[model samples]
Target: MKIKVNSEACIGCGACEQIAKDLFEIGDEGVSKAKVSEVPEDKKAMAQEAIDGCPTGAIQGEE
Candidate 1:
């Protein structure tokens, strides 16, 4: 599985980073983006949590 962050949609809220620091971070003018393209097996659940927790629905997941 993989994760993608919509730069336009992100508001730099940092929720993803807070929820899954290993998988996400604030970057590119302070937008929250995925730290890795492919989600690690152990981090997958937290990645989904970050996606679901994002207020703007900016994080997208790909299998």
Candidate 2:
């Protein structure tokens, strides 16, 4: 799976980064960014958690 952060929608609340630092991060622009291009099999659940936890619904997952 691939994860994407929509900069326009992100609030930079850090919920995503807190959920999965390996997959998401707060960028210099104060928006969440996907650190990985693809989610590892073992980390897919964590990525999903981050997506669900995003208050602004900025994260999107693509299978």
Candidate 3:
């Protein structure tokens, strides 16, 4: 699975960070964005939860 983040829609709420700090982070611009790392299968659930927790619907799964 691939995760996509809409930078324009993100509010940097840190919900994704709370769910999966390894996968997401708040950038200097304060937008919730993905970190530069490979996502493990164990953290997939948390990643999905983060995507769901995004209030602006800025995150999505690609395939």
Mark the regions of model 2 whose C-alpha exceeds 4 Å error after superposition. Answer: none
Tens-digit lDDT track of model 1 for 1-63: 899999999999899999999999998699987889999899989998999999999999988
- Per residue, candidate 3 scores C-alpha lDDT tens digits across 1-63 of 567778999988888888888888888998877873446778788888988889999987654
Among the numbered candidates, top TM-score falls to 2
RMSD of 1: 0.8
Lowest lDDT block of 10, candidate 1 = 27-36
What is the number of backbone collisions in each predicted candidate, taken in the order shown? Answer: 0, 0, 0
- What TM-score number comes out for model 3? 0.85
Candidate 3, superposed: residue stretches over 4 Å from native: 36-38
- Name the better of 1 and 3 by lDDT: 1
Instruction: Estimate every model's Cα lDDT from 0 to 1.
Output: 0.93, 0.93, 0.81
**TM-score of model 1 relative to the true fold?**
0.95
Clashes of 1: 0
Error of 2 at 9 (Å): 0.1
RMSD of each: 0.8, 0.5, 1.5
Whichever of 2 and 3 has more lDDT, that candidate is: 2
Candidate 1 has an lDDT of: 0.93
